[model samples]
Target: MHTERSAAAADRHVGDVDLTHWRSRAGRRIAGAWAALGKRYGAMPLLLLTLAVGVGIAVLATWIASEVYDAVREADDVAVLDRPVLDWALTLRSPTGDRLVTWWTDIAGTIGMPIVALGFLVGFTVQRRAWTPLVLLVAASGGSLLMTIAGKDLIGRARPPLSDAVPPYESSPSFPSGHTLNATVIVGTIVYLLLLRQSRVVTRVWTIVVGTLFVLSVGASRVFLGHHWLTDVLAAWALGLAWLALVITAHRLYLTALHRGAEPEPGALGRS
Candidate 1:
């Protein structure tokens, strides 16, 4: 009886070991997958390429738009997208709309993006997880800033002919709007981050919906407030979307790198 009991206990011990081994193997696989994804999306070369391409496109577009401005200077109605829908959007002025526009533009330009970049740094340090998101964020913002200044100087297109309320700030180039670009970066970054963390369809839908609304609102506000022309806003959106695509591509590269055991640096995306 004693021998039989000992044999049964030995069998149970072996089973437990097998179960633990399987669990460990599964955990490692999951970790490996996550690491791979990060590396694939967050590599330095990939991100740099993305930034280069985006800046290059911005330069090209700005130059072309400047040519258009020169040719169309004599036209009284020179707006490209002059639909009533957009015009109505331009005229949507309420005290609340004005306040919201001012608030979002101020926050996005000044604090919101910086804070988000900081959060990515903090999270990366604490969690030792993905850090590529932050890198792309910094690249987008810094590149956008450089491109904006150069474009403004080069293009020098005046703001839209204002018939309604005048902007508090001096209007510069009417080809690409800084406010619109910043809005897209801030909101687009938010959307990309959400895609990273949320896998559920419903959750992603909500995130995208809310994010889109916010971005569009900010862009529209600039036009409505007479701060930017319709073409300027549209150009900004196009440039911002292209930059965002690059970021997403970089993110995928980071994921692949993570799988290869290469850890990314903190604050990769927090360039101010």
Candidate 2:
């Protein structure tokens, strides 16, 4: 009986040890998976981001119909906010307000935006030595430029009438605001890429707020100055946001592939 009791105890102890070991292994596996997912999406879920991209594209489509097809849709209705918004915008006219709006517009312009974006990219790449962000910046800037040009040329939507516009008018098509699009792409990309490296919650929130405010201000300046219709600015917001989201998704996927030790092949969908 004594020998049997001792044998029973030994078996129970061995079983407990095995169970504990398995539990620990399972825990580590689960944690690692979550970590991997976090790395891939910057702590955001992949499904949610993809869904947002889809929504943005849909909104952009509505704008295209309104501007490109001249479809009767509320989204395309320049009159939607024309009278009220323009009336209100006129209230902001003054030497000081004009200066501020012009400053914002100038900074969001082609030359100004590219300088700011490339400057940040150079600094960011220098700090991290990661080819991932460099590739992302190039793609985002190039894609934004191409889209803006194509939209302007193909849509051929005329800018607001000269009577409504302030001085220094633009001659390009006005389906989408170039200043708004450039601002959203450059500011949005900068905030997204930089925020990925920021670990502090407060800092991240502040970064997003500042970026958003800047983009919105640029768009508002365009409308307030009568450069682009409100609808045009809205379309640019949707377009730029969609493009920015796509850029971020690509970057996340790049990070995930890198984490898995995948060899980035030439002429493939990934980079160094």
Model 2 misplaced regions, further than 4 Å: 1-69, 73-76, 264-272
Q: Tens digits of per-residue lDDT for model 2 on 193-221? A: 76766667788889999999999989999
User: Each model's TM-score, in the order given?
Assistant: 0.66, 0.71
**Which stretch of 10 consecutive residues in model 1 shows the poorest summed lDDT?**
1-10
Candidate number of the best lDDT: 2
Q: Write the per-residue lDDT of candidate 1 for residues 1-272, one digit (tens) a residue.
A: 12211211222222123211224576557445545544555445544664577667766765676666556655735554534435676556778877777776664554765776567556633332334445566777776676567657876777755665344565566557776776686568757665544546788788889888877877776777677777677777877776666555444434434335544444342321
Candidate 1 lDDT (Cα, 0 to 1): 0.58
TM-score of 2: 0.71
The reply for model 1, stretches above 4 Å from the true place, is 1-54, 61-77, 80-91, 94-97, 111-113, 116-130, 161-163, 257-272
lDDT of 1 at 252: 45
Best by TM-score: 2
